[model samples]
Target: MEYVIKGYEPADALRYFEEISAIPRGSKNEQAVAQYVYDFAKDLGLEARIDTTYWNVVVKKPASPGCEDKPAVMIQGHLDMVCEKNAGTAHDFEKDPLDLYIEDGLLKARGTTLGADNGQAVAYMMALLARNDLVHPPLECVFTSMEEIGLLGALQVDTSDLHSKYMLNVDCGPEGTVFVSCAGGLLQDISKKVRWEKAGGDTVSLQVRGLLGGHSAAMIDHEMGNSIKVMGRILHGIQKQMEVHIVSLSGGSKMNAIPRESDAVITVPAGQGDKAIEIASHIAATAKAELAASDGGLYLQCEKAGATERQMSLADSRQIIEFIFLVKNGVYTMSMEMPGLVVCSSNLGVATTDDTGVQLTDFIRSSDPTIRDHLDDEIRSLAQLLDIEIAPADPMPGWKYEAESPLRQLFMKLYKEQTGKEMVAVATHGGLECGILKDKMPDLDIIAFGPTADGAHTPDESLDLASFERTWNLILATLKALAEQ
Candidate 1:
């Protein structure tokens, strides 16, 4: 199919989107895109500023003909995207254009994320900058980097440069719903260093793979499989029935993603080793039966182990399994006011074992401050019980919903006028830039909404074609309404 840009409005949008697709703006690696924005603004004769601390780029567009005196409004979105790919897929984020292509009426990348999570919104902002027809107040377009890793960019942004009393963040995943609140989160670290000894026997390596892993925060309550938890159960079962020495264990790629696969090395006496293999197969069968409907391809494979060194002592092995089982891995509570909303949750995101000890990382989330604190207390308690060192971190706060938020009302009215249907206002289970930006501009009016996308932060992530036009209309209408006010 041939792509065309007949008008300047969408022409600018399409151009910017295509340009960045080739720039490789993965998280914390958005310097090229940031510089692109800066140079674009300067080339267009607009005053642009770059904040070195947070690496936030802003373009100040002077008010148009009749709107120069109107109150300024800021439109923001992140520039970086989470870089992830499927196993066996040959792709390099450091030097690739994402292999962009249109399929089944949706925009996506080949075997990888399209980065439309925030890229589309950034493209829209860039388009607006190139056009002079957009209505209302003086405008500022801000693009922040390192948003995927954390709210690092927003956390370090110089709010003193902000001249707007009201702000609109175009980072929500769904198309029609307006998100005004999101969950607060923190990263927890737990580690233990214990001695280990070798047990004479036949060594075997176990591999568990093919489970559909997803975002820890968004998919935690789904009861989906977790590699660390599954492998721990197997190890515990084997140790209970026979003596086994754990040589090594590893799982998970990122702290924010649930582990989908794991591998472990253990040694068992030749005679008892056959029994261990049978037990592993049985466990796999049971797990497959229980997870059949959701995780069909889950696998557990055992291969004869080559010569291996010593394994952890019984004491160390027991303590490790106990810690893994004791730590929470899913939702702890549901929202009382909002049905199906996770109020508190935890994820055992990563695990690794070595001669000294094991290191674990857990990601905790909650909309209620008290609940989050209690969960932290539980994590600390577990460390004490296991006699291991525990460390916790303080993260950004959640954006609490405001019942009478004026910005939300305006968004609703505009949404209805554009579509002739009621618009839903919701609080997301995921993170948003609103919470961090609101901290700097305490009274800043904030609302987040974006084009429709599914399987975000995963390989299946894709953007809906229809939502592109709908959301663009809603956004344009909202901008006009703000200007008229």
Candidate 2:
């Protein structure tokens, strides 16, 4: 395939990014990318180790010239991307390469995610290691897997060989903004046994689509429509007027992404089909108006569906619908200290009703440990009240902000000198691997910053070329300053 990235500064970084983009590295599937990094390190005669079990790669390069006394710096990023695409885009994330294209000075993937989130970070580390002229201390390039799925690789990777007191996490957003803290998060699954019986009635398919879904933790404050909740409302409204039984229902794919589309098959009384459509249309219109500013493309439709042999019992159907409607979603609260940052939030990421039961998965996030515990309790209490079985996954620790950090202070100073503007140091609502790594390496000073990117964890994700060049320069300058210390 022909490369689409050209005429960009830091040409080596851009070229490596394109090469990384060609590999399929979705969460839990990072073998190929990890191997690629390992091979690159081996080819350069650098000491490297690859842990296939966790899909992590660690490479060490000696300090340049007189900078041997400087503390070793660890550069970290994940090897995976959240595999997301538009409704009808026929691209296989496991085998096929991403179809990358350039648009309006930004790098994007056609009808799919561009994987620039951590891919660019990998490219930066690779380019830096490949160079021989840059004056810097000993470098340890660490790449972990499954960051999008709760930072699993970071939590499990063996870092005993690493000897870095200062770490640079290149997995942040908005160029020039340094992140010192981020929310901790966990995954939860709720389910209930559902019985099905033969149905003899008209079937209708209800669908909710076109909402601008995004990263649950990062964009929950945007007030975008959640398709699962929207579908629940429409279903509840229809059930209030007529009797119906669900045949099958499914929505969303990943626990980290807000569902953009959902559909359900239901059998209603022969004469009540018209009423169901009318109710769905009314609800869609109301939702559109309410979410016009955030999700203007919101659409809901109901049409006659083919006959089905099995349908969920009315009791089970009603219970599922009520559960979805009652579940807490979106921004639960804002931080008192940070003003605009989201302090507590949850995303009803996935829902499916099948032969055995109705299953739902959610990702809950909170910067405060107390709030995180409270949210977990709230979910359990709700499940118990509804008589549903629930299972909560192990939670990752949140990175707390420290007012005094030599690394952050140095980065801020360098950023100001290079750009003539003070870099904003703020906490993020999203979960980052830095939090997990910090917990393991308590004495390490960490800072995360990256180039500007939009629509992450979604098919519309894009990276700004201009911001990429600028951020690259900043990283080089920071490394030089660190070595001088």
Against the reference, the lDDT scores of all candidates come to 0.80, 0.87
Candidate 1's TM-score: 0.79
Number of colliding residue pairs in model 1: 0
TM-score attained by model 2: 0.74
Cα-based TM-score, every candidate: 0.79, 0.74
Model 1's alpha-carbon lDDT is 0.80
In angstroms, give how far residue 53 of model 1 lies from its true place. 6.0
**1-485 per-residue lDDT for model 2 (tens digits):** 46776564553898889989999999999999999999999998999999979899999999999999899999999999999999999999999898988889999999999899889899999998888889888998989998987688999877788889889999997987999889888778889898879886889998999898998877899988999889888888888888878788789998889999999989899877877888889999999999988898998877987788898888888888777878888888787766698988999999887679789998888777788788888878887877787885778888877767999999999889988998998899878888888878878899999999999899999999889989988889888988997
Number of the top-ranking candidate, with TM-score as the measure: 1
Clashing pairs in 2: none
lDDT string for model 1 (176-207, tens) is 78886788887887888778675568887898
Model 2 has an lDDT value of: 0.87
Model 1 steric clash pairs: none
Could you tell me which 10 consecutive residues in candidate 2 have the lowest summed lDDT? 2-11
